[model samples]
Target: MGKLIVHPDYQGNGIGTALLKEIEKDNSGLRQELFTSDQSLRNLRLYKRLGFVQFKIKPLSKDLNLVFMEKKPGLLEI
Candidate 1:
């Protein structure tokens, strides 16, 4: 449950990666989940590379879909 946002003028400089790394560093051994629009392909790829897998997808509106993803780090899946 965290938010990471870098101003449009400051993007593409690894700010988002740094933020996620720091958060994941202080919070290990627990499953982490996040939600984003299906249209966010960049975010989808980033999450996948970070070990998150699609947990579910639910319709948000007639023109958009929401994607739910989760990562367990080094923990076992129940």
Candidate 2:
């Protein structure tokens, strides 16, 4: 999946989590991978909470980097 952003007004309402769960359910048995900015702590936490692990990091500039995360097949509990 690509960027999953919930509107700020609707943030913290489980919208992002539900979308991710649906994606996982649809792609069962396949590894799921995505990337986000290192500066996005909230995104990082959300991804980690959903079973994604950091497997790589790509530097973009002095103050920016891309964090690559992946969830192994069968790791989804919901």
Candidate 2 deviant stretches above 4 angstroms: 76-78
lDDT of each: 0.81, 0.90
For model 2, how does the per-residue alpha-carbon lDDT over 5-78 read when each residue is reduced to its tens digit?
89999978999889988998899899999999999998899999999999999999999999999999978542
Off by over 4 Å in 1: 75-78
Q: Could you give candidate 1's per-residue lDDT for residues 1-78 as a string of tens digits?
A: 566677889877888777777777888977789988999887887778777899999998998999999988794332
lDDT of 2: 0.90
Clashing pairs in 1: none
- Leading candidate by TM-score: 2
Query: Model 2 reaches what TM-score against the true structure?
Result: 0.91
**Model 2 residue 58 CA deviation in Å:** 0.5
What TM-score against the true fold does each predicted structure earn? 0.85, 0.91
Residue 24 alpha-carbon offset, candidate 1, angstroms = 0.7
